[model samples]
Target chain A: MNDSQQNIKKNVLEKIRHGDVVMRPKIYFTLQVIVVAVVAVCAFIASVLVVSFAFFSLHESGELLLLGFGVRGLLTFIALFPWVTLLIAVGLVVLLEWLIRYFKFSYRQPILKVFFVAVCVVCVGGLLITFTPLHTNLSDTADRGDLPFIGQLYEDVHMPHEDKGEFRGVVVSVATSTITITHNDHDADADDGTRVVTVPTNFNTSILHIGDRVYVAGDMTNGTVTAYGLSKF
Target chain B: MSDSHPPYPTDEELVTRVQHGDQEIFGELMDRYTEKLSRYGRQFLARPEHIEDLVQDVFIKAYQNIQSVDTSRKFSSWIYRIAHNAFVNALRAQQTAPISYFDFDTFTAHPVYEDGHAERKEAEEMRVLVEKGIKKLDQKYREVVMLYYFENMDYQQIADILHVPIGTVGIRLSRAKALLKKELPVDTTHI
Candidate 1:
């Protein structure tokens, strides 16, 4: 070998023999990549969940329950649907893609390819998550006064409660202290319509009958409606 | 007399041997890449200062971090990627250029249109023309040019080294070739 070549080899060998650095095991980098991939997947799954809620809200329309909203209602529903949940879902997935840039392979990939793949994965996962029993459990917990803040959010999307203290429900039972009412599912406001209301200690309770459809104006605390005024629908 | 070795072992085989407690074999690998990688670094840096130090640093780093690589991959790509990063980081530290400022969002290069299959010329002339053309390109395109022409790597290999899609490798090469054709013109016979 030439002098310069010999010199390079000598210098390289010197560095290696110094013992100042250790070669990390290949498995550790592999594990790190695996961990990053798992985190990305988790972000994707969470994004799907947010999208599922948006799907459930769209399901709020009574017509969609039967799988036919007709053209006009469908158009209006699309126009008026609060898109925050879906928007947040999309934002979340995009953020996950941004996170993917940390990976050597992902950062080098075309943005379109990554984005398309991410959206597809999220949509498929989101649809499956939306159909799962998770939403049901959340709704149940929300009605039970367990979750903070967003608990009432679930109740509002799935049930019709008037902004002006009005609640519509079918009277399930009659009692002197409290009358039980299942929320009116057919009302335009309550899509799935499953919130239960206990109307308590109102003077108009004497007029309420079993199975009577009624509208009560009241404060809902822990999913119970306390009526200041009551009327028969 | 017939030789027991298969002329030269493939890079993958060499790596397997290295992983099997064969530290000495790594020097052989370094000898193979030293000249080529040094040229790549020189072209990238566009200056002739501490290039030997840069090349030596790549060897040292690659050796120290050898175990971190997924051995299933082509060793050359992994090492080249390390070299590429080292070069880019060194250049970026000088504060001249950020890596990716080109808006590739709208740029889609047509492979067939940019293919230079008809660009027939002598190897020496082609080499000179190519070197000049590559120097004129932005780094994004330059790396692809070097890998394709100087290193004689396939599109897939280039993709692996650069961490881009296989199609992206083709596209970048195509765009680089188009840029070259603009910088220097030539005539060729198509059969």
Candidate 2:
């Protein structure tokens, strides 16, 4: 190396060594590791808590019950606790790393590597947990109801009450909570004119509106058999 | 290799020792990396006044956070990573709250030349021109080039430091060199 290059290297080495001594303070590394670990734990706990709270809130609002009483059914399918915790821990670590990057914090080199590996291990643990039969079963139950053909029947049944006599009509006024069906036959009496029925609050009542031709099937009790299902003719 | 200084411990060994509470070893690490890191910091930030302060900040952070570092990985990369982060943060701070009194021209003035020979002057001018060319390049290209040439890091090492793919490092280096060659009167092709 040239004299200048050699000088530069020497200067760098000397400065680094000198500065290393001056800058290196005792207990800093331990403190840093503790800080990182604490931050990771806090973030994971916060995220899981927030998610659980939102889920329970939705359930209490009757949304989940209306959507289908699958919450209890799916609970049996959850992955083992150890696997879930491991996955959450891994997710939290990754999140912590991203946060560290965002804030531009530096940890000791050895500690950083260990933190990274711990995160990866947690991620693998989570993936393994998610793939377990219990987890898969829970997911399937949530997406599709547990009872073999009951879900389809629940989805297909839309008429007010199924026991009423056959009545062909087109939907007229539809309100926030009710559907008014008007029969096509002009000779139909005013008392038998437009059939107003109460629809379940949970039903996707958004799809039904005025002017939809529908075939209704139910018994005619007091001139109104509650229609069980309505088919678009 | 024949220097009077004791041989520097490998980063892993230093980390293991540090984890065991051997605080002295950390000082050795600081001594090992500070100068090269300062130069790297200098390349990202133009203000020579802030370079030492910036480098000092990086070392302090490294020393303080030493326990968190994974012992298995190369200590050098981790230290460089810290330095790079420090440099970027300093640059960001400068952008958000700029120092109005700072003058680039004042910082660029050459240290007084003791030898006034024509050959020495020309060589000095060449070195200045090279530095000027580097300063003119975009930050992305400038960073890779500085780490590769001034820091004496290979493409893979530069990639790791910059958090880019090896191919990206190669591309940036080639572009930076081409840009520098165009800007400098000196024949960088031969260099």
User: Which sections of candidate 1 miss by over 4 Å?
Assistant: A1-6, A61-84, A95-110, A148-233, B4-7, B101-126, B185-191
- Winning model by DockQ: 1
Task: Tell me the tens digit of each residue's lDDT in model 2 across B1-191.
Answer: 57999886687888788767766565566656766876787778867567766666676667656666777766777789888888877877767565343223122212222232542335444445447687898767777767655665665566567554455565566566567768776554344
Q: Score the docking of each candidate (DockQ).
A: 0.39, 0.05
Query: How do the residues A58-139 of candidate 1 rate in per-residue lDDT, one tens digit apiece?
Result: 5542313222323433453455465777788879888898779776666556767788888888888767876788877887
Candidate 2, CAPRI quality class derived from DockQ: incorrect
Candidate 2 chain A minimal-lDDT segment of 10 residues: A155-164
Candidate 1 per-residue C-alpha lDDT over B74-175 given as tens digits, one digit per residue, 9 for 90 to 100:
888889988998888777766565656454632332233324344323334545657766678887778877887788677667767776656677677667
- CAPRI quality level assigned to candidate 1 from its DockQ score: acceptable
lDDT accuracy of residue B45 in candidate 1: 75
Residue A174 error, candidate 2, Å: 20
Residues A1-233, candidate 2, lDDT per residue (tens digit)?
33443443454445646654333444665566578667866775554443333233232222222223243323321311124434554566667655554222322122345465645554455444434454334333433556364333222222222232334457887777657787533222232356765543364657876787655443455645354444454
How many angstroms is residue B38 displaced in model 2 relative to the true structure, after the best TM-score fit? 1.7
The native-contact fraction of candidate 2 is 0.06
